[model samples]
Target: MIAHSVDDPLYYLHNFRQVLLWVEQRYADLLDPHELAFMQAFAGLDAPAQALMVRMVMRKGELFRSDRLEYTEIGDTCSALQSLEALGWVREPEQLSLEQLFALLRKDELASGFAGLLSRPRAAKSDLLSQLQALAPAPRPLSEWFAQAPVRIVQWCLQPLCDRMRLLFFGNLYQDWSEFVLADLGLLRFEQVPFSPGSRALQQRSEVDLALALHQCAERLEQGERPGSIVQALAGWHSDNPWLARRHGRLLFALGQQCERLGEWDLALAVYAQSSHAQARIRQVRVLERSERWQQAHALAVQLAEAPANPLEVQALQRVLPRLVRKLGGPAQPRRRARPAPVIELELPREHAALGVEEAVRQHLAQAGGEVHYVENTLFNSLFGLLCWDAIFAPVPGAFFNPFQAAPQDLHDCDFQARRAAQFDACLGRLDDGTHHQAILDRYAAKQGLQSPFVFWPMLSDALLTQALACLPAAHLKHCFLRLLQDIRNNRAGMPDLIQFWPEQGLYRMVEVKGPGDRLQDNQLRWLEFCAEHGLPVAVCHVRWSEAA
Candidate 1:
């Protein structure tokens, strides 16, 4: 009945028959031919034992004690049943009568001879098959091994197999080796699926603005376009507005990465500086370190390390700190001694000569107000202003040449001219506010291109909100914020600067509305330094009511 079907039930029945043959081999020496035949049929069986064997053979596969029959029925007759159950098979046995046992014993002393056969060392596969042929009237050893072996092994041993790599791992067989083959094949299959765009976007979005920028830069690469100008523009705008800065920063970082891949060191450093995203920034710095720009990379690493504690900030710092320290420790650095300060007279834009940071910024609301254009000179201008105010000052140390110090002759450098032209084209390609943002995100996802900073401002603002809120806990602050919003929505109160205090330590925090010009002003810098020195938390808030300024 078992042999008639191809299912597991038949498979196990065939397997049990082989175990019976191996058992017979163990008692071969003690058996007279006639005695062997009687015992082989039903050695110790009573009428019940004969009936049970008939039932076992009649069923499809192996059976287990306690599967249907209880311990009381099979009892001692199926002593090996428990072991077989653990080996993934079932069992049933019928009790043998005393007369049957006597008849079986007179026929063959099988178990005694079987013990001798078991004492011999197991033969190798090819040798064992040869030995099986010599042992006549016994079931073939090769067929028995085939029946008892695991299905996977049986298939491989009996069938021819080939692999593309021409890697013959299985030709050298040891126990459990076939399992290794299956595991390797499974892993190879798993790796064949292509990466999805949504998953790539999700994975990259630690800093949304930056991620988007990288996405754009990657798209540009795919399209065979240059990303450096977009990167520099973003870096130029970062400090004045973090939101916009972050998007450009991301783009620059992505571009810098491509530059690094192309062996453009100076370009990569510039890109790293513009990326507002912490992860991209870290990656950029690592590129700097790899290029052996140790001092610059170290300075950047320190700023990243000291960035306010958020998950991304903390993780970025942790990842690079050990490597940064190791690089710093490797060589003695030649310190450039401090130089005498540059005496620079302050010259304001002719339009706002007398206005301070606050007043200059307030002018943006006026009809004649000129928005500040971030130029290479603007950075030096801001630095020069800060120095004059004594809020913070650094002497322009003696150096052979400041790369940032523009020279009339250097303007003739074709590379620089090309860069400027590319930036101009990028700026001119700006999209309308709504259309541009989705375009930027789509381009970023495809790793193809970037949007102009004007069009990218919305994404930047979102990054700022995310970046700022991540610094404060919502539990104590959110409820108060919502209440203020509710009051404003119903026209019950005017929007007010937020100021909160905790009585326990007399700790106070204040938020003040300011324009970008005010935040960048000398007085704001003074106030910020004062607050920092006094260990107070003060937030300078820049509110934008319009999508475009």
Candidate 2:
């Protein structure tokens, strides 16, 4: 891997070349003919051409003006564009639409180009576009639109091909070439997990095509496309790959939610029924209930409650089952109530309102003998991340495919802990033998600044780590870690807002602060119950601001 610096003129080109090399080495078997040809052709290009190609690909839009393609390293833009144009990778478009033209041109340029057509030359760019669009002018090349304009517009034709390469390298469309620059600049750092020979995010070419197709469907849905249309389009596509299957299910789930928002209950039910997402069934039940299909909702709710998917589902079921029973005219079932956390009431000065509720509470609770820090979910998660660093980063197949991942791909999967049971057991074993303290401290020191899913490095300090380790019991840590392993996606959040520690007394208390008119959220309620069950000292601090006399 090549490290990039601000002084390096060709840093982006280096990054693009690294991605190409990585894809060629790992995904050679999966690459199609066009992609393969692109790799070969790109490799054979001259330095200036390669740099110019990368600059366009890394940029925001496909359309580029000749005047704007300026680079000091690549001496002549026109000269560099020759090889690219010859290969048909970049070329002048046959015609540019009104919208495309408006996007490419500045206000001054638009006024100059269409001086005769504009009703008001002094109007804003938006008004100019509206005026021109109302005329319904035919699309034409820049040369025809503005004969006197010096700049020529050319569109990069190879964006889709380049996007496919990027997708293969990053495993998703959200992360792009900027990751390389961020890593190079020391703005972001990722753990180095050794990849096995078979470590690939997508095993088959069909999976790659399916992933891209699914992404397009998601974009269409977001753009207000009908849920039924998207559902119909998704009907024929299916993937045996778990990762792809998960993506498919999530997309369907999102579409289902959108349908619900639009009051299309039947469509919501239809979409949810086809989805394999964990919460899809519950959503289906909710939709059925809303649509007045009480019997069906009751039946499905009963089925799910018999063997819930996870704690979150169980929690949902507990809330919905009683109402569903009443709606169906069934016998009333006893509602199980969560044990309430101890409460602390306080009336503080209104002048401290600027500090925010959590901070104000922390300040009020701070004493000479005790310290209060607004840790929220960071402290426990960080400790677990540090102690279980090896287990989390263990080179499991499919867990890690690329070098830039902050966490394993399967971190939220149901079998995440099951697959690495022995490793996690070893990590958690240190707690039982009283070695966890030293292990956490050592890991914190060594792995500081390296990205981890749980550790918030900026908020965590040596003093806090020392105080926490001294005050927090190992048993409590074990319980929290075990719960986190149960359902990492949901269980890792909803911790109390502040923690009060007394190093001298070797005691600590977690506090959840709620200001006037505020209430506990479901996740926060679950955490408080968990703490109560495990005999952990935690409290709910309700704060009210005093009125001025």
Segments of candidate 1 deviating more than 4 angstroms: 1-219, 228-249, 330-549
- Among all windows of 10 consecutive residues in model 2, the one with the lowest summed lDDT is 179-188
Evaluate all candidate structures by whole-model CA lDDT and list the values in order.
Answer: 0.35, 0.88
**After best superposition, candidate 1 residue 244: deviation in angstroms?**
6.7
The positional error of residue 89 in candidate 2, measured at the CA in angstroms, is: 1.0
The TM-score of predicted model 1 comes to 0.21
1-549, model 2: which lDDT tens digit per residue?
655775788888887888898888888998889889998999899999999999999898899888899999988878889999999999999898889888888999899878898889989999999999999989987778888855788999988888888888777777768766776655667788876566666888888898899989988998999888999898888677877877888898999999999999988998898887768888988998888898999899999989887778888889888998898788998989999889999998998888999999998899435989999999999999999999999987667766777898788877789878999999999999999999998998888899999899999998999999999999999999999998898889899999999999999999999999999988888888899899999999999999998
Q: lDDT per residue, candidate 1, 458-514, as tens digits?
A: 233333223223332332232222222221212112212333334333343444445
Q: What is the alpha-carbon lDDT for the whole of candidate 2? A: 0.88
Best by TM-score: 2
For model 1 the local lDDT of residue 407 reads 17
TM per candidate comes to: 0.21, 0.89
